[model samples]
Target: MNGIPNELTIERRMAVPRDAVWRAWTEHATEWFCPLPWKAPEVEMDLRPGGISRVRMVGPEGEEMNLTGVILEVVPGERVVSTDAIAPGWVPQTAFMISVTEFIADGDGTLYRASARHWTDEARQQHEAMGFHEGWGKVAEQLEAVARRIA
Candidate 1:
């Protein structure tokens, strides 16, 4: 994990069914999944290996971040792996910052984990210092809330 700088790891357990959690993560156009503060009005997802998932999250000051990443693997109601970056496609916008998110089932719920890989230690430390924990933690909370409601 040392070599992978700018890397961020988050693990959370939510009380929801695996399938429901998967839907929250995979289903496009589910605004509930995006949650409050960051409004994701639309999302396009293929949910298959090699397929691309496009997501747009609208924020304050009319700010919008368009995220597009390819699905590396998907095991139905179990696991999903995808790499995220600022680039328009699967390409990395910055070599120092990239992310891989993994969803795993833990007992009656699902355990969500995301790892951010950076090109250098400096970048990693910078990101950590920038409050990644709270940022990702909020999204995780949103995911759990939506999943529980739909389940």
Candidate 2:
């Protein structure tokens, strides 16, 4: 995919096979989807185009953040693309960003890439200011740990 001016990209290399990584992602998502102190207690994924992908992140203090989106693409152990611009059944929502997560074979492990394509440069900047890298990086590390355990 061509780089978009309003996109934020992050990648990591994990000592886990692509299938293991994908399994951890799709099956054990709630265990590692959020950074520590903020857990995802609710997660639902239809795993198909136009299907719903939802998560409710709960902070240690009981604060909650809800995310509801529609899956735009899914490539099994390879890639997933989703967006908050639309909900299931093609319902429109307040547009935020599109997220893409990719898993690639790398030696005996996997290369993981995650990106967010914001609707505007301002939105991208806001995401950065909200600790996107640090937060998402933590999630990736947690994901790797979960994958290792499940692998």
Candidate 3:
């Protein structure tokens, strides 16, 4: 609260058009969004303003983490904003967060960026210590693959 907020900004170049990148963020593409070495078992996406997307992943120990959020805004082939407020059925989130994802055309490809906003400085530090870079980085790498496949 006294200093500038801490955040993680990740940028990746995808060998795909903006539209293809959009698909990878939608319901049908949740599988690929799962960072490798983990398996996604379920995905439900309602891709529109106020719509919701829920994804369930299975860890190595078969533990499942279900994440769900509502779409705050969606600009086809441009950007998507979503709040990690509630889970499926509008259940409260254990760790609240908001995400803004953008896709910029980079001449024959797209520049993809996703930023996460937390409520407190401590939360931000916690996320950083938790390896958001490695976790999200892996997912971003997977995103490039998914986008290229459909490009």
Scored by TM-score, the top model is: 2
What tens digits encode model 2's per-residue C-alpha lDDT throughout 107-143?
9999999999998999999999999999999999999
Candidate 3, 14-125: lDDT as tens digits = 8788778777766345656667667787876676877887778988878888788888788877887777776546667775677878899999888988878787878887
lDDT of each: 0.70, 0.94, 0.76
The order of the candidates by lDDT, greatest first, is: 2, 3, 1
TM-score of 2: 0.97
Candidate 3, run of 10 with poorest lDDT: 1-10
Q: Count clashing pairs, candidate 3.
A: 0
With a 3 Å backbone cut-off (N, CA, C), the pairs that clash in candidate 1 are 5-118, 6-124, 7-116, 8-116
Answer with 2 or 3, whichever has the higher lDDT.
2
Provide the lowest-lDDT 10-residue window in model 1: 86-95
Local error of candidate 1 at residue 136 (angstroms) = 0.8
TM-score to true structure, per model: 0.77, 0.97, 0.85
Show model 1 residue runs off by greater than 4 Å. 1-6, 28-35, 84-93, 96-98
The candidate with the higher TM-score, 1 or 2, is 2
